[model samples]
Target: MNITFQKNAVTLLGTPLKEGEKMPDFTVCDNSLQEVKGGDLSGVRIFAVVPSLDTGVCDLEIKRFNEKASQYPDVKLYAVSLDLPFAQARWCGANGVNAVTTLSDYRERDFGRVTGTLIQELSLLTRAIFLVDDDNVVRYVEYVPEITDHPDYDTLEQKLNQVIRAQ
Candidate 1:
């Protein structure tokens, strides 16, 4: 998908993953520099992809998800960025973003490339949201057309509620 980065048209590295697609095998570094394999994660997951935590919009997106995630205690919320692991840890600690686990794609951009969130021009992940179920199938996806815009939080909530209702 093509996203406007500060109004400049830039396309993603690959076709974005759509709902119903299985999670691709990928690895990302946690805040502690631990390797996390995407396939190993089992349960409802909400992945919030951002460019960097230092940016105002990325900061707010993760913070808002971290704050609201408490209501859905069973769901795993993750914030992925291209920043280094130490920086992610520092940002999470400073912002008190405990509810969301931060992951870094600095080394290989494994997760970003597999998920098609990597921006071709900037080599950064664009703003997006992916909701994956226990079986590892993507149930909801929101690839924000613009990097500066926020994803539809209410629609995401409704999708989560739908998952709850299904159970």
Candidate 2:
């Protein structure tokens, strides 16, 4: 898909995910450098994919999610990126972000390829958010048309509430 990054457009590599589809399983390194399989994560998960943690917007985005993470202790929130595990760890430590988990896809880029957030030219993941239920079924997906734009927070909160109410 064609997604813009501050007016510059780029194409994503794989097919985009849709709601109700099974979440694709992939391997990524955690902040501790431990390999984790997406399928191994149980319960509701919110995956926030970003290009790089060094960027201002991406940094703020992750921090924002981290701030909100405590509201839903049962849910797993992940900040996915192509940054090295060491960098992810450093960033988390420097920012005092302890709630949301950070995963690095630098080695295989599996998370980016599976989620169709891989930006071909940039070799970075495009900005996107996905909410997957306990059954591994995707409950919501937002592929931000503009890579620099933030996902709809209001809708995300509302949808999360709806899911919580249904459970």
Please give the RMSD of candidate 2 to the true structure. 0.9
Sum up the clashes in candidate 2.
Answer: 0
Candidate 1 lDDT score at position 65: 94
TM-scores of all predicted structures: 0.97, 0.97
Write the residue-wise lDDT of candidate 1 on 35-89 in tens digits: 9999888899999999999999999999999899879999999999999999999
Candidate 1 C-alpha error for residue 139, in Å: 0.6
lDDT of 2 by residue, 1-167 (tens): 56898899898998799999999999999878889999899898899999989999899999999999889999989999999999999999999999989999998989888889999999999999999888889888999989888888888888888777767
Model 1 clash tally? Answer: 0
Query: Candidate 1: where is the Cα deviation over 4 Å?
Result: none
Clashing pairs in 1: none
Worst 10 residues of 2 by lDDT: 158-167
lDDT of 2 at 30: 88
C-alpha local distance difference test of each model? 0.90, 0.90
Angstrom error of the Cα, residue 62, model 1: value is 0.7
Q: Which stretches of candidate 2 lie over 4 Å from their true place?
A: none
